[model samples]
Target: MPSSLSGRTVLVTGATSGIGYESARQLSERGATVLVHGRTPEEARAATDRLIAAAGADAARLRPVSADFARLEDVERLAEAVVRDHPRLHALVNNAAMAAPERHTLTEDGNEIAFQVNFLAHYLLTNLLEPALTSEPGGRVVNVSSSLHRAAAIQWNDPQRIRRYSRLAAYAQSQLALTVFAADPRVTAVSVDPGICATGLLPLYGHEGMPAAEGAAHVVHLCDPSTEIVNGAYYDRSTRVAPAAAATDDRTVKRLTKLADLLVGHTA
Candidate 1:
């Protein structure tokens, strides 16, 4: 795997900590030029340094990029910077996501924080970088989704959850939307459920699961060139599985994509 990605470049969002950090480290060790993205410049730099230390002789392959997912403008800027710096991105790992916000809050863009960060921002970024992704063969887009999506439904009438809000529901809905979006055929894409990792996210809910590194393995496997995983599929760790019924609905996917485009102000 290391030799396969020796000359390739990939971006891992939310690489500042948790599963994202572990995923970045693994990819860097595999000789991939990793763009480590965080919500802040300071954290991004720190994560990049950690990855460099872990990569040893491959230190130079890691780069840092920061963008607050809560801000759509920041997401747009992040994508533009990525295209300007890396003209041909071989893969994209949309691993950045947020959950368990104590209260329902709206971002500056007027979208719910979880909805924007967990799905819409990645949606916009992937679309913006479509050209770079398709410029090379075997380009991949891995969306870090969750099994919890199976228990949630898209709030079509209240997509933002303004009428009724629950942190769990918001997070699951965002993941479901992402799974639906990953079904698009424009690029080689897959949605992954990293299992219930004992990351910082779990503690907020009064529980813990597996280590972050263990959970990251699922993402690393998807990024592997040798994996026979099909595009537009959902996986629980390394096993392909059916996602929520809504996620498999063609009509739902289209509706979600249309709403996402409107939210991100993307014409297409």
Candidate 2:
């Protein structure tokens, strides 16, 4: 393990693979105790094992928590467990998201699949974890967003996409909103676009992008407080990037905050 983040407890969602896996790996190797979160128990277990091995079990610490983000109830429950168990959370990396390929599908809670999984669930998770974030001195909430947010469609009144769904629009809007909201007090929230990353998210566009490790580097940078300065700034790779027009608007932030309050409701 390297240094700087020694003894810190970090939680990373979507640790099963891709950017989440790499961020967990790098953080763990650098002496932070990583809480590896995944939707499935089996996959979470596998990711935990890989991270422990990659960073050396004694050198790296890990905790596995599983919850399906598509279901808000599960996210709330997961948030409860983490808060009760780990109060001094140092970093929260909200890297879990889904990109729907076709017309919007409803989630278990009757919300749009892309919006529910990409933004709302993450928002719920972060709000639930806010105490832990502010408990210590402060914490970082790094949201893995994308550059496509420039063309995002924020159908604020209809996150369920009841009107109609453009797959890319759904994805971009959700990411943009997520990054924007993470910039709350005592939380250094930043969204970073893993530009054209070679993940499972691009089947609709017929494009596969850069290697997952290459795309994950900036996420790790966000976790490392040394490279952290601009509290709510969006990042592209390592450089700072601007969010969408909506992401920079206070009206949208207030609306999203209210929606989050109504949605989370201390359930967990």
Candidate 3:
């Protein structure tokens, strides 16, 4: 791990708000070049400006990128742009996520909205950007997973939950898949439950929570080269912890990868 982040480059998804936004700001201030992702180009640019104005972040260190996670095509385009421009990406903070809606809604891509946005989209994007994610020792992926995953199970036969739907269940399933993804051998990655934070997903947690920065700190910690990490490991804040039993199961990771590839129309 390098003592300084000056030469590193990190891409943070969902950087318009919450923990994602704070993570981008903190990383930029630490001297790392950050690609701030949002759902739209306007939103991405606005977030970049806000970081400069409010956090005194260096404008030169922030790059704005956009993609609507609900659309797999958009994710592919986003990956193409990143791989073409940043050939040696140092880290990827897979922080973009959305709660399942009250009703079972499906995207035009024909998958549950939350499932596509929260997990499948990242799954596709990461695979597409493989050429860019550096193979260097400190390079890795950080999945902003949730503790709620402990209570959820992957509805394998009906991943979209077409017959039965619970917003909380849907959200939890997505988080669980993300945790399981860290175990993927294709990439060196780790998942973390940033703790309950007062972000857009706070309602799912059932109470007021800590500031977003506090949660972002846990995420940013893992991004630092100084922090040692084990691929497939899960964390509760700064502590290494076991996640749901299924999250570490080899069969689960392989199964989820196959399912995600099918859902997203991806080959690998």
Candidate 4:
């Protein structure tokens, strides 16, 4: 691991607010070029401006990137743009996500809204950006997963939850899938449950949570080259622990990868 992030480039998705935003700020403060991703171009630019103004981040080190995760095409375009512009991306923080709506909803891409936005889109985006990802020792992917994943199971045949729907279940399933994705051999990656930070998704945790910056700290810690990590590891804040059994199963990783590829209309 490098002693400093100087010259390293990192992309943080869903960076417009909360932990994602804080993570971007912290990364920029550490001297990495931070690609701040948001759902829209306006939001992306505004986030960069906020980082500059509020966090004292170098404006030159922050670049705005946008794509709506609800739309696979948007994720594809976002991936293409990043790969073209930053071919040596040192790390990718899969931090963008959404709470499942109270009512069951499907994205235009025909998958459960939360599943598409939280998991599948990231699945597609990470794979698409493979060409851009750095192969250096410290280069890796950090999945901002959730503790709730332990209680969820992927509905293999009905991932869309069309027949029975519970917002909590839908969201948990997505998180579980993301955790499982960390085990993929194609990328060096790890997943972390940021300890229930107070954010838009706090309601799902059923209690008061810590500040978003604290959670972002856990995420930024993993992004630091000084931190030693193994692929497929799961962490609860700064401590590493076991993830759900399914998340570590090789068969499960392969299955989820296939399912995600199919869901996002990607081959392999």
CA deviation > 4 Å runs, candidate 2:
53-60, 204-208, 264-268
lDDT of 2 at 135: 90
Residue 260 of model 2 has an lDDT of 62
Q: List the residue pairs that clash in candidate 1.
A: none
Per-residue C-alpha lDDT of model 1 across residues 6-59, encoded as one tens digit per residue: 888899999988899999988887788999999998999988887766546266
66-180 per-residue lDDT for model 3 (tens digits): 9999888899999999988998999999999998999999999999999889999989988887778855656789999999999999999999999999999999999999999
Give the lowest summed-lDDT range of ten residues in model 3: 129-138
Q: What's model 3's TM-score?
A: 0.98
Consecutive 10-residue window with the lowest summed lDDT within model 2: 259-268
lDDT tens per residue, model 4, 67-125: 99999999999998998899888899999999999999998989999999999988998
RMSD per prediction, one decimal? Answer: 1.6, 2.4, 1.4, 1.5
Which pairs of residues collide in model 2?
none
Q: Cα lDDT of all candidates, in order?
A: 0.86, 0.78, 0.92, 0.93
**Sequence-dependent TM-score of model 1:** 0.95
Candidate 2 local lDDT, 14-97, one digit each (tens): 988888888888787777888889898888888898776764654338888899988888998899999999998988998998
